[model samples]
Target: MRPLIRPKMIVSAVLAALVLAGCASTPEPPPAPESTSAVEQWAALEATELIDQLEALPLDERPRDVLASVRQDEVVVSAADGSREVSVPIQDGHYLSIAPYLDRTHDCFFHSLTTCTGEMGNEELTVRIVDDRTGEVYVDETARANDNGFIGFWLPRDVAATVTVTGVGGTAEASVQTGAEDLTCLTSLQLT
Candidate 1:
């Protein structure tokens, strides 16, 4: 019998090859914050920008020697093996990165921007977010999970909303808040 080949692995491999070949296109990056070094400039970029840049690089080019974490007000990038660090402030709204899982998940409060994984990686999903109290729709679009199997969202600050994600396995719903105290890593939305 042929060895088992999961569809997800194939997709992930294709995506990885595209990234390694620099065929995956990202929007023109905005002006970098004034800094002394390239790493410093990258570290000072907004959360989305940093993630985009990191995703665009070839595996060998990424700062694998560093680490990433989210705080209530900022995304922190620091050298994993050293003492260098930078805090990129959250601007405009709250950055909420979610990894909706199907079969497994890990306990996460603040998202590890560099290393969190979800079961539904490399899948397309339809996500919709609506204001729970005012009935205002915030987001309704098709989103693709990144290499890490996570989709990040920027929500209006301090609002309570209902987040519904539709994936291949099924749909999942959860309540979310974009407050100063809310968790940044949302991983409990298991598709049923």
Candidate 2:
């Protein structure tokens, strides 16, 4: 004779089936990352009013070399004053000249861009500058943009070089020649 099926057994079977079905269902995909706004990106570099001061210097007093990096929202000026950090809006080509010669040792300025956050400014970057003439790695370093989204380097004047910048957002390479006179070579790299 067949045994009678109990109500509790049927309920237990149904619950087990439901649990297995729940486990089998696909999970939702993770949310996409939010893009940063221009204004928010400008704030990350901790930039200040340094450009204005740099621009205000008279031509005679200005340093011969000036390097500025241009980004989507802001310009990073390699020249900084003490702990004062400053940022300026980007221009047709963000250019400036400052005098009184702070640290004349460094003559090259490098800028790298991949992306930026409202909170952190421009993305951190690893840059490598190779001396094209001798195949020497002139500079290999990781750095964050100053308030103005610019990174600075000191290289011998009148040297040919190649710069490679890498970051989480992308990588870029550029070629430049150090100026015979103190000069600002603004190298902008697109991170992609």
Candidate 3:
């Protein structure tokens, strides 16, 4: 038996739609689902699975009441108002999500899986990431931005590094730390 649609294709379609919707303006934040069961369903999903779904959903289909953020140690899934929540420990490598922008950006302490926006959506940019201590180059290639105008990386846990993103806007550099208490979202870089 074969699946009707490949999972990658579904995700790509969703991302392309988001990028198109955001090209002229930022799409409205996903509204909370009407049923609390939506949150429960998300709670049942494993960390990576949950992250994948969260990254793939369209704004209208997202459960707005839940705020999902990935961190160094675990994924925090909670109600937007903080009335309920859960944490799923990360079992392996660390994943970092970054949104590099030119003129617009938002104040995000943690990257929200349901809502976070950046400029230059659907752009293929040159990205370079290096370990600050080991002098190892983790990534030296071109990565295309998802519809949300962000790129993600999988790295070994417990390290600090510098990140540079170069695109049509220009270039920008920033630092990242993957520690027990470090944030998983990087949106401070700006193209000059």
Candidate 4:
């Protein structure tokens, strides 16, 4: 019985050693550097140049609610055409105004929940506006024909508002508040 116990003890020690060897973690290789072709580099620089030029223009000349950043993946579909990706970002309680590439668009049309577009014509679109604070509606008007496809309306400075727009051809929504200054705007994006 003692001799049998010695052999069992030796086998147990060997098994423990094998288990420890298998538990060792392997070292990972360093990540490779990002690759950028000449064309891609040039395109990036061109985009930067365009942004700089646009920044130099007066605020009025710039597109309304020009999204500085985006938080969620967005899909913009057109009944006439196909679709595109639009990632719009915002600060807290801020909204965006989007032009569904449709004829009717305005500064406040696409951004808050207070308003939404009701109907559309060959060159016109309806919009509705909602007040975020009291959950009251502020506007529900169909806009006149627009040369541009869309426009944006920001919250009155420091005021909270949410706006959403939906129709068969398009849909957009955002949360916003008038920020620190009278003209500053902020927004947030939510996925459903």
Query: How accurate locally, in lDDT, is each candidate?
Result: 0.80, 0.49, 0.81, 0.39
CA-RMSD of model 2:
17.0
Candidate 3 positional error at 153, Å: 1.4
Which ten residues in a row are the worst by lDDT in model 1?
Answer: 53-62
User: What TM-score does structure 2 among the candidates reach?
Assistant: 0.38
Ranking by TM-score: 1, 3, 2, 4
lDDT of 2 by residue, 1-192 (tens): 999999999999999999999999998899987995433343344333434433334334444333334333456543322232335554232231111111122233423221211211244768788889998897788876443345555455557778787776667777767653323444345556
Question: Which candidate has the highest lDDT of all?
Answer: 3
**Candidate 3 local Cα displacement, residue 112, angstroms:** 0.9
Give one digit per residue, the lDDT tens place, for model 3 in 59-102: 56777788887877677888888888888777887878888888
lDDT of 1 by residue, 72-129 (tens): 6887887776578888886678777778888899988888766676777678999999
| For model 3, the run of ten residues with the poorest summed lDDT | 53-62
Better of 2 and 4 by TM-score: 2
- 1-192 per-residue lDDT for model 4 (tens digits): 464558889999999999888788565788997985322332233322422333334434543332322112211111122222232223233323444433433443222211223123223545566778777775566654223333344333355665565544565566544554222212221112
- Candidate number with the higher TM-score (3 or 4): 3
RMSD of candidate 4 to the truth, in angstroms, is: 17.2
Model 3, runs deviating above 4 Å:
1-36, 81-83
After TM-score superposition, the amount by which residue 51's alpha carbon in candidate 2 deviates from its true location, in angstroms, is 11
* Pick by lDDT: 1 or 3, better one: 3
